[model samples]
Target: MAKLKLTAGRVRAFTCPADKPQAFLWDADVNGLAVRATLGAKAYIYQGRLNGKSLRVTIGDVNVWSLEEYREPKTGKVITPGARPEARRLQALIDQGRDPREVKAEVTAADIAKREKTKQANTPALEAWQAYIKARASKWSERHKADHETMSREGGQKIKRGRREGMPDKKEPGILRPLLELPLSSITRDAVAGWLEQQAYRPTRARLAVSLLGTFLNWCSDRPEYRDQVNPDACTRMKKDLPKPQAKDDCLQREQVKLWFHHVQRISNPIQATYLQCLLLTGARRNEMAALQWEDVDLTWNTLKIRDKVEGERIIPLTPYVKSLIDGLKPARVVLLHSDDALKRSPFVFASATSTSGHITEPRIAHNQALKNAGLPALSLHGLRRSFGTLAEWVECPAGVVAQIMGHKPTAIAEKHYRRRSIDLLRVWHVKIESWILEQAGIEQQKEETLKLKKSTAA
Candidate 1:
């Protein structure tokens, strides 16, 4: 062994090269031990010798650990040479004449850890997840934003409705409420595990809640920040530790959809009726379609520029039925319909009278009423969007093309960044989708049906 040079950088130069596989020896200068970098890289480690054995510790990157930056693992504070805690421990071990084999073993494990980290090479999970999200930053929106952020943003933590509420409402959205406020890093896997442990007995919600959290965090692991730091144990092997809950079998029956549409047509609020019809026809999100304006609709061209598109403005094909629905709106309401305060200032297509500018904060009561009138289950207005996806798949719409209409980021590997703007294909999807829903709803265009019904009532 060479005499200690007494400088941090020069420490590496004095150490002997490995004579055998995975050798461990103290650096003579500072007695901070050194080890080879992992994955054939220039990384090395600093080991602390205490009690006649080395306590393995991470110094820093091979060339990057400055004298000023050198640290002790226990206190996480800087240490000067000769006064290094590990060196003091080694002196104590020497005085006792007891070999620090246990300490050496710990150092060996620490060295292997340093090498293993080098092998990962790429950015951490949190980093990668953030970058992935940022890359598709344009695709995110409050209407459809939760799907992407559900994981890192604590989308998994489910809050139960109080025994009194029975269901989520405007003041509280039930189990989904609290997690939305927290970031991924703030909650530890232990914290999540503890949360899951509390709810584990409630198999269905427990699985969904934990799975959502796990999947999101798992995705985070692919990124750089959490890859090494976040634990996999919390989410993985869920089926083994806690069984998964059975998922709901969704989709309204054709008769149910027909019954629902009939009631939808009679809902006193014409705009709500029209918005519901549009939902059936276009399968767009409520706000995305609700925020439509007369300008976005081109009666002459028979198309609606779906401005509420999650990604950006997209031109949705307006079918004859969709056109009829729009064309038939009473002229008196058109002014209010497009006015910012028409629906209490909501600017929503289904704006309530209470909202300003036709804008609505939420449509909970109205939507539920419509659903109940249609005699449908407790499905969400959002579920209608899912129905559209299912039906589109049923009708054999090309996966890529349907994804485009849904405003989803394309999954086709070669089609990821494709910006196709042709309306020819979209027209086909719009028509097929409309036919499917209208067929389910039993809505047939009766030219004077509106008149005949009015006359019968008047008579």
Candidate 2:
């Protein structure tokens, strides 16, 4: 080793020999500090003995670090004490039986933790809301998942449809957008109450939003990462201020069926017309019918497999008129074919080529128009389903039969535990009810004898 007093000129001029991999010039001022030169680069380094073992650490680049202390000319302030003082600090730690490497690691870890804490403190509620949706999405239905997404949307998107002449082209922000933009920890009970007050115009939607927010906060409380930032009680006692939701009673009357069926059959789109009629006849929920795939309908067996929210799935009699309506959708399905194969058809029974879900999305516009054309009172799509249960009473159909066909949960002990009517028995009552409704609407359907003969012949 060669000892020399390090200077700017000397440090800059040092280089490794052609045959050697590296070379070092020891500094006389600092016992452990040296300038190491590799084949391609030069850097200041420190070397010392700790616990009777040799230890080495790189200080910095020779061009960036000074050989001695540096000061600003005007203020006489110490800019840097240079690599020599850093070397002395490492030596001091070694003398005290402490490893400088461990001390450096501790300082780095503490800095990282502090930054993480600050980042978590500033994290928006939207981020956690997204995480919550992702974690729980698999357990929810498609409609339920879409509800959460809709409530949290930031809005201002271009309106694709339903934009009136004077209305703004952009959609408004979602109901929960304001609260979701806030920091996660800032969602206190008072903040939730204020949000509810602002949304008082739409009490029904706001009440549902509050319920969703409360569930989200509960999910966050269960997670260790978000536990400290969330107040699970933030949504508590908020619902008391909002009005209770009234049960809808917009069902079709027995006398109005004639006019309702007449106008509904006149809908320009055959799919929409048949869909509204099927809703009335089958008594199936709107989503369950819309999401019906081709495979779920068995025309041969006269059965329709419905995805039930409670029982997982339930099979009901696909009544004669309803079967004919579905059969009519086949030609339209043929028009949607991408290839010349006639055997292939759209997966959805109520298929829509334009919809993202490959099925009918909104039939409300056409339905409302049909009602208006008939001079009938307003009746929603679900009202058609309610009408089915209501009309079944005219035939004196058993309550259990209607409940089973509608996929309603069993309420009576006999209905739940003892009564397990087969599909054949259900079909008997279902056909009679369908017959009675069609009689009121003045629509002539095929007789059960003809349907049975056709089934036997097809077999």
Candidate 3:
């Protein structure tokens, strides 16, 4: 039988075995006890056995564990080893299907997680945004990141600068300030609706802020720490008053297009003049064109493939005029003249001196400028896209063809499930959109201007 030494000053030592295979008995003189030592260098513990069965519990190094530091794990408290009876009583609960060890571990983990969330809530709103970004941003795509960056300025203003002088990055409003620091648990739909009403006071800005808020809240729900914090509770009446978002559409008429085209051509800024020309010809989003890279265009195929398009990959056939616009552009090779990045800094076709890839970041500025110059109301940049769509309709292009050229998906619901092979439809789309643009530009039909395009059977 192996024995332990009760040494000087009530100190206890389990004399380790010198032999490779050996066993020792510790606290056999008492109940609810454990042993210590190791296979090689690091010592461990084996404790708590019942009947003939021994259960092992490794209590780390002997040098680290002081006898006085030891205590029993039962009775919702710590007790002396002299009260081994109570410790055994608690161990008895485990034998009867209760795990105090696992329970305690869970409690400690819960406390840590709770404290972490508390810290997060206590953090400044912008700082918390940074933390959340560091923890969760890798899952987002590049365009998704860019969109967030743009909204960061558009929703709330944060100051930043470019390498070039005479240019400052445009900032978004601080729409997220009200709820940015609040714990998701404490947030309410009623509070959100009230914030929404505050936004409604501005009409346009409120809708933008609320939409961004809802999107971010949904994003937060995907996080494990924020999973339970989604505020389902809101005052009933406030939910009814949720403001409708303003549509980002700006399609125009043939008459308006005729006027707008001339208006854009007369702009003093050469870059804006060219940018406007390309916008009319391609039927592409203003920002998409602004962000266009030489790599994104296939000059050989005479096609503009926008992979990061607002809709999707919009494959628009290049007209001769479109080709001329590109050729006439000073070859920055890979650079977008509008955006102030690298020779190939951005793959944007249009860019601004500021941040938004295409040097042309804010449409409102351009819209106001164009309208002021053209002697018209301040229509949206997206309005040009709308105008393209509207003009295509005037030329009697099929709705499906127009939608396809615009990179819109088809469905069956039937608009949802049905996929129309738009290759043929796209050909018709090219003819009509191009024709409408020329007609509006007052470019009379030339003898050689005929495009023997595909016929659209759909109404």
**Poorly placed runs, candidate 2 (over 4 Å):** 68-78, 161-169, 222-228, 335-344, 446-459
Give per-model CA RMSD: 15.2, 5.2, 8.9
* Model 2: per-residue Cα lDDT over 1-459, one tens digit each: 779988989998999999999999999988988999999899999999989998888988987888777999999998866888889999999999988888889999999988886898898899999999999999998878988999999889998754545889998888999999988899999899888889987888998899999999999999988888889999998999987777889999999987888778889999999889888999999989998988999989999999987788999999888898888788777334434434445788887766667788789888888988989998888898999999999999999999999999989888889998999999999999988888888776655523211121213
Clash counts for all predictions: 45, 0, 38
Please give the lDDT score for candidate 3.
Answer: 0.57
How far is 408's C-alpha from truth in model 3 (Å)? 2.2
Worst 10 residues of 3 by lDDT: 450-459
Better of 2 and 3 by lDDT: 2
Model 2, poorest ten-residue lDDT window? Answer: 449-458
Candidate 1: lDDT of 141?
66
Q: Among these predicted structures, which one has the highest lDDT?
A: 2
Tens-digit per-residue lDDT, 16-103, candidate 3: 4777454444544334444444454333243564455555544445445433334555654544222234345446755776554555
- Candidate 1 TM-score over all chains jointly: 0.47
lDDT of 1 by residue, 120-184 (tens): 43323444445656755685565334544543453334543222246433232334334423444
